[model samples]
Target chain A: MSDSTLTVERVSLRIGTFALQDISFSLAPGQVYGILGPSGAGKSVLLETIAGFYWPDHGRILIEGRDVTRAAPEARRVGFMFQDYALFPHLTVAQNVKFGLQFRRSRPRPTEHSQVQDLLARLGLEQIAERHPSNLSGGEKQRVALARALAMEPAFFLFDEPLSALDARTRDSLREELRTLLRELGVPAIYVTHDQTEALVLADRLAVIRDGVLLQEGTPSEVFGAPVDEFVARFVGVETIIAGRVLCTHDGVATVQVTPERRIEAVDHGAVRSPSVLVCIRPEDVALNRPPAKDSAGANQFPGRVVGGEPLGPMLKVKLDCGFPLTAFVTKRTYLDLKLAPGAEVVAHIEAAAVHLIGQP
Target chain B: MRTQTLGQSRGLVFVFSVVGGLLLAFILVPLLRMYATQTPATLMQIAAIEDVQSAIWLSLEAAFLTALLAGALGVPLAYLLARTTFPGKGVVEAVVDLPLAIPHTVVGIALLFVFGRTGIIGGPVNAVTGFQFWGTWGGIVIAMLFVSVTYTVNAARVGFESVDARLERVARTLGAGPWSVFGRVTLPLAWRGIVTGLMLTYARSISEFGAVIILTYYPMTAPVKIYDLFLQSGLDESSAMAVLFLTASLAVFIILRHLSYGRVTPGGRRM
Candidate 1:
């Protein structure tokens, strides 16, 4: 790792009934390591522990190759943006941005005042520099918080559900804005959130945590496309996960029997050592077609009836009973053109490459 | 059903207004009647008296000192109570509030046991410094503080509780030490509650009679002096002094409240 990299080495901490067990991850400069977890899954606790708010029981936190495990938060040079944006209600926007500048032990930079003004102006907050937090909108508070944290010129940043409190419309726009800002700043960051889309968009590297345990860590697509377990499959938006037994393997592809009469073809990747397995399929990967009259089923094709579906924006989330329940995402136009509705017979086609198989534990 | 519920609420409001208005009148009528009995000339005469002036000054000074001391000693305890959980915290909170539950005279006697000339703390300090709490300004301040410190501690605790702990954590992340965070973030955010508490402590201390008379009857506070005049002369003479003291207290209280309120609502926005 480079000198600017942050490494959490085998960190384990227990707060109340929740504990993070031997969790470890590292982030290089310009990397956004997103920790994705459900509520009460100890994501916030892990972030706080890294920020020096809580000490780990058995681990070392190294920032810039220096152990900061026992350091006070002020000595750690880590910027933390809270879920609620935690803007000081008593201070104006300009003053809030200027707050950390006075505490710097280094000689004051000549352009410090202009630097703060530039930050606020860049975030489009210069007009309301004199307004208190209560007078600003949710998006405005978020920008001010970002400016304040960035003003400190921290080595790393930790954001806990930074956009969770905003309305959906604001959250969507700010999510893109935040991604651009993080990329431009080139500071390593740990963004913790339960929102899958946010993690997918913002994370250069992603880790899924559950019940205080780190389940999986990889690139966003690697973790989303090839989940290690059934929980991860469901969490990363894989709508269909069903138990299956491998019947045969050939050319790195295995035919798994989901039911007595139904089977699936999945690329084994040589990880499946057991006969029992889970067939994980993303909804978008399943293609729907008209059922054939003859019972000439393709390798990974199954005839089924549409049980129900609902329109999700421009796409439709379709539930089909292809011997076993399977979910498919089809465009609204496809649904209309196919005259697909409840009780309509259709064929679901899943390619071997699209099917992810995890050995059943 | 909604109309019936609205009508019932209206009836409840009517009943509340009647009872509340009667209580307000009950409190205001006595003070108004006392004030009506005193003319401007008589009140001016009582205010001009050197003894009355000195006694009122003593009350203000003692109460101000009590408030300052309570703030310095009680704010940390308040912050701990607001932020941390510990064993026997309930006991500590109850002890802080014990004076409010006890009679003022009992508080006076309880304080006298610890602060008298021959008392545990008072004896050693008097032996070393040749200063005593008996009939001294220290006794007056101790008496007032004993009965009034609860307001400062409780109010400051509530104030500290109102501030979000995350703000302090963020301040630390921005390179502020513990004391800097407290001074820059927590103190500013919690000041309103602390100030309100101090104001209540000052008002309560100034009105303290039972405790003050027992501890130091010679260097008389306004309340004790008014009691002395009522007993020594008659209602007419004492009422003039009462009117003067009441006016002074009301003026100071109103001015303090106005100043705080004005600062709080700079843009005419209700926080």
Candidate 2:
């Protein structure tokens, strides 16, 4: 790893009944490593352990090639943005931002004031500098928290659901703002959240955790597009998963018989070394077309009927019975263009590469 | 519908006012009657008495001293009780509240066993430095503190508890050491509770008569002196002193309450 990289090597921690088992990842500088998990999955615990709030039972956390497993949080030089923002309710915005400057012994006195001013200005918090936390709105508090943490000039940043407390509109805007801010600061950050959209948006690399185990880690697209297991597929919003028997393989494609009457072709990717497999397909990748379209010879296309659908914001989630149950997400414009409704005849078209196959024993 | 609700609420308010008014009159009637008994001239005469002045001074000094000392001693225990969970925490909390459960005389007697001139801590201390808690200002302070320290500890604990632990954790992450976090974030956030606790401690200490008389009668606090006058002279003579002391205590109490709940900005700075 580079000198600016943070590495957690086989770190294992057990708090009460929850155990983070042999979790390991490395984050390069200026990259945001997002940890995605459901509640009680030890995502926050892992972040806290990296921040030196908890010591791992085994393994080590190293920041910039220095072992910080046993260092105090202050000595670790890591800035943490808590889930609730955790602004000092008793301090104004400027005071809260300046709180850490007093403890920075290495920095000379002259630049600290201007540095705080610069951070406040950068976060657009100068106008609210005199306001107490209680008087500010949720988005204002979040920006102040970001400015405060950035003011510390930390070596690394740890954010625990920093936007979770805000309303949906605020959270969406702040997530983009946080991503831009993290990039500008050039600090490696571990953003932990259970929200998949947040992980997809903010994470340069993502890790999915469940029951304290690091299930998978990769680029957001890589993890979401091709999950390695059934749990991961489901967690990443792969709506169609079916047990299949691989009857044959050719040209990196496997013809898997999902049911006796239904056969599908999916990219093998050399992952289908076993006869038994699970066919995973993302809902968004499945396209619905009106019947009587030209079906390319031997292409993965099946005639189906729309069983039901519900409007999901601008997209419609259509349940299809294509000899087997499948789900497809289409835009409202397409739904209107096709005049899709319950019992509407449709053709489900899926690409070979979109069909991710996970090997089963 | 709004008229019906308003009518029902008016009837409820009438019932509440009747019971609350009776309770308020029960407390105020005797104090008002006593004030009416003494003219301004007679009350000034009693306040001019040197003995009464010294005794009132002593009471204020001892109570203020007790509050400061208890704050120094009790705040850390309060923080610990609020933040940590140890094996015997329940027992420790109960012990902190033991004085409040017991009578003041019992507290005085219990303190005497530890701080009396010939007692455990007092025996060695008296021999070493010729300092004695018995029949001294120290005796009065210890007696008052024993009975009133609970208020300080409990109030500060509630204050510390109201502060989010995450704030302290974030402070630590922001380059603050543990002590710096406590001073900057925890203490300031918990200040209102601590001040209120100290106010209550001071008020309770000033009114501590049972423990003070049992420990030391020579350095008479206002309450003990008033009792002494009531026993030696009669109702008329002591009542004047009582009214004077009552007025002084009320004035101080009201001022302290205002100071404790003063106009503090949301940032916790006093405005």
Candidate 3:
């Protein structure tokens, strides 16, 4: 895209036993691309590569259509915010924000002071400007770090687990504020985190990585609704992942036999001919009812015993065993009205469109 | 149970007091006795003496020079040691600490072997400079540095290690070159540890006697002067010199310690 602010082209890096193999992504202006993965997924390494801390072994990085793969981080015009905030413990909040400005090649504009002041005020960090980083709360430290990074007014931003170091409550609140901040800045940003919800909420697009390889990349809804593989499906909150045999493909729909008596019909997305495949169903997509009427017979409906039910805030997550286990989350009010319990019999309905088949790796 | 813990703690306190107290007294007694032996009148008289004053001045100058040199050479080495993993890193670390483990006298002898006249680089160095490390202020500084630079290196290593590398990366991305990152972010953050290291180096360098004596006794440091005075004229005169030197060094050291470690103002700008 002409408006792409950052493009990482086939970037690969080898560090000891681990390697990031051919990671390629592009982010347009006003886009937040979240890299979601487990801890050792090389997410931070990719972010650092973009930030010019680590040079990739075999790839190019272009910022605003200019090749800067070999450029120094300072010359690349990138801003990075670390997980720990890295607020320069020796500097006050105001001074930390001013640190980058002093090193910038451009002469100070008349609005420099007020620009910094405006950032601090916008982040609600004005009161703590004179205080050192050690004195600020986790949320405050995050805001100050954001303000500092923004003072540089770089081409793009890279964040490494930005909200992970905060407590859950603080993370929840800061997540929204950060999303808003990123939106308001309207700059392409790469947000790296292991949390799916964080990625889903903050990123305009999501990349799922595992073991240093880019597994899948798509919009939040696309990745969550239909992950490309089992790893991605499980990582993106699809609670039920079933290894099944492709019994047959009929009229562009594949019948995946999860068990002898349990078969699922799914529209084949071109890999159904594989001997083995994984049928992934999101818990939110599975509809559960106390019982099905006689006229409600469907090829994808099955009788199941409720093996477990747990309340998750306003949702009740129910586990079912219909030859194979399936999980479904129902509204708490509906769950309560249904009188669902561990030993109760229920009908599980799965629309063929909602059943995604990924070739077993 | 409460009484048992209290009694046990009391017994531990007694034991600790006895052992710690003996060691404390052992250190404090000689210095206190040296100070007590000199009246403010005798101290003033000693201070007024040209040799004593010169020796004191030389010691301070040599120590300051030693610290500055050590910091310049050792800080980069410390940063390298702290950050990078090389083949012989452990050995390098151990070698840096070799001075601390070896006897001060042996350190002097080792310095003599390498930097002394008629020795390895010493002969060539002597010919080139028309002077030898022996009987020179350079020798005194080298001697002091040989024994004390480790403290600076180690302290600076710890300081550099404590400064998170992530911050450096962030600085780089924020448009700071490597040198700028080091100067603005790494150095400022690690300043306290480096300052402490320099202070230790200064204190160690100023007090060094054996090495300085072995290497260059002519331009006497305070300790060497005190030793020479003790040999030529017994206790009273030497004690007066010791008292004067101790008070002056201690006062200066205390003031420096206070300035460095004491109330570091906000933003730590003073540090």
Name the candidate that leads on lDDT: 1
- 2 or 3: which has the higher TM-score? 2
Model 2 DockQ vs. reference: 0.69
Encode model 3's per-residue lDDT on B1-271: one tens digit a residue: 2434533677777788789989999999988877766788877777788999999989988998999999999999999998899999999999999898888888888888888888787788889888788888889999999999999999999999988888888888777888988888788777777888999999999999888888787888899999988899878888999888887888888888888766453355453
Q: Sort the predicted structures by lDDT, highest score first.
A: 1, 2, 3
Question: lDDT of all the models against the reference?
Answer: 0.89, 0.88, 0.86
DockQ of each: 0.61, 0.69, 0.58
Query: How well does candidate 3 score on lDDT at residue A342?
Result: 89
Query: How far off is each candidate at the interface, as Cα RMSD in Å?
Result: 2.8, 1.8, 2.5
What is the DockQ ranking, best to worst? 2, 1, 3
Off by over 4 Å in 3: A1-3, A108-111, A245-255, A267-271, A292-295, A311-314, B1-14, B37-45, B113-133, B262-271
Clashing pairs in 3: none
- Model 3 chain B poorest ten-residue lDDT run: B262-271
Top candidate when judged by DockQ against the true structure: 2
lDDT of 1: 0.89
Q: Could you give candidate 2's per-residue lDDT for residues B114-169 as a string of tens digits?
A: 89867899888999999999878999999999999999999999999999999999
DockQ of 3: 0.58
